[model samples]
Target: MTGSVTVAGLGPGDAALVTPEVTQALSRATDVLGYVPYVARITPRDGLRLHPSDNREELARATHALEIAAAGGHAVIVSSGDPGVFAMASALFEALETWPGDRHPEIAILPGITAMLAAAARAGAPLGHDFCAINLSDNLKPFALVENRLRMAARGDFAMAFYNPRSKSRPHQFARVLDILREECGGDRLILFARAVTTPDEAIAVTTLAEATPEMADMRTVVLVGNSATRRVGRWVYTPRSAESAAG
Candidate 1:
């Protein structure tokens, strides 16, 4: 009995946001694996075995899921938001690269709404134009790399969405990020912080680079920095669709 590994996204915090495809995948899974909170979202069942682990154990978890699949068990790996967006999908492939076994298990990836899209929707169409998403965690990469990306994005005038902007361990990095943004985008550039989005504790705040501070964001927050053309209409923040209108 050949088995398979399914990587599914549970969406953001809301159960309503979870796609039916991902839900169906979970229902059919023989074993489920993911970070603790994401795995906790899965309901306990008679035949389904849940493997919850720490966030940093992604590669090991991916390997374990593949191992289960190799043994003819249907393994599902869950990620909050989209699995491909700075989540388990990449790690799964990385684990697969070093697999010693010749018979590789079947693999599938299911997409879901990421925090950037969810946050952007709640705060209005700040990403209506060209945009890019950057992970600021610096866990697997250098802070200098993150800084360079920020600078390049600003210089390119791209609307930017940032993930893992701030955490307790590196509280001050976001401050430097804001300083750099101020220098590149200037004082009037709009920046929005959407925290705990799609949950009961959700909060969204929009401000300018001059007034924005590091304390406005956290690990759960997705930050949006708009281009010069971004502005507010009524209460919604949006960037113009036309470059000529944006320039004018």
Candidate 2:
């Protein structure tokens, strides 16, 4: 039997949030490959093999999963959130571009609940209107590109969700990001700092751009900035579904 490769999302560190489809895929996988923390989430089974690697080794992990699948071993590559959202699915396809074979192994991409959606839900519909998700890490892309996108998103009056907002290595970048947001969206715009949503250590903070500090975010946090119309009602923060004209 020809082997197949599946890229699955584990869903934001919560087993309860993992979809039935991903659970079924894991049950049938002979070999599982992913970042060390993500691989650790899978339970050991008699016939299963788990290969865990460092966070920066995405391309290598994807290639190894493809090689295993091509050799008639059922392989699954796991990612933290939805595989297509800045995760392994794109890396796998990049590896497939250089894969040498008469016929490639069958591949599948299974989606999971992404971090932004979970964070938004926890914050009471802050993303109720149109929004854009941005990955703030400049590891693969240029900082200039990220700045340009942020400016355009704010200019279009779109709410924004940011992933990988801060890390020890890139500490000052998020500060600069906050500066840009403050310039574009002004100091009164509301921003939410959500860390480890749906987990035991989860914390959510809602504050304005002026009140939001760079220290408020870390690599584990997902940052959300509300548009012009976003506001708070009682204990909840949300953007209305309808658009209001400037004349009104």
Candidate 3:
């Protein structure tokens, strides 16, 4: 009896963003495990157990979630944003490989609306062209890799969406990203700040790269750095092709 774990992105909340498929899976789930805030979104039902864990206890939380599913029941792991984007799916795989269990359960990854996409939508398609997401947190991966990716993205002329830009402990990470961008793409590059999208107190701000500040962003803000080809029209920001620009 192989039970499977289904990962669902609950979107920003219980509003229109919740997909029919996610709702169906939630209805059928024997247990739902996630970081505390994500699991708090849904109402609990009979046989629908909720396992909320500390956010930093990622690997352990995933291992426990899988164990629950392998015990002859259904399980779903909830990630607030897209699981693959920067969420639980990879950690789950990593934990499995770190301590491979004899009883392997079926696992499946489902997509959810990522903060960057939702942020882009609110800011009028800043990610219309090439873009990349880099986590500025150097605790896991070295900052050198982060800097390398930032430089590469800048040189490649790609719009950038930076995740985990800053936290309490690591406060100066985004400054380095900004400096790199300024040197590579000039200070005139437009930037969109989407902080805590879909939440009641969400904020959206647009500014130039020269004016971007570390205090303007935190772990929750999805930083958007427009490519050289990117532009702003009225309330929207987008990357337009030279051919399209000429045609217009």
Displacement of the residue 49 alpha carbon in candidate 2, Å: 0.2
* Sort order, lDDT high to low: 1, 2, 3
Candidate 1 per-residue lDDT, tens place, 117-179, comes to 999999889999999899999899999999999988888889999999999999999999999
In every candidate, how many clashes are there? 0, 0, 0
**Per-model CA lDDT versus the true structure:** 0.94, 0.93, 0.83
For residues 1-248, what per-residue lDDT tens digits would candidate 2 score against the true structure? 69889999999888999999999999999999999989999999999999999998988898898889888999999999899998999999999998887788999999998999999988988899989999999999999999999999998899999999999999999999999999999999999999998889899999999999999999889999998999999878999999877411
**Backbone clashes in model 1, listed as residue pairs:** none
Error of 1 at 36 (Å): 0.7
Q: Which has the higher TM-score value, candidate number 2 or candidate number 3?
A: 2
At residue 227, candidate 3 shows an lDDT of 82
- Deviation in angstroms for 10 in model 2? 0.9
**Comparing candidate 1 with candidate 3, which one achieves the higher lDDT?**
1
What is candidate 3's lDDT per residue for 1-248, written digit by digit as tens? Answer: 67778888887553578778888888988999998988898789888989998878888888887787778678898998788877889888887786567866888787888888889988887888868887778878988998888888888778899888888897777787788889988999999888989888799999998998888998878888988777889988887754233211
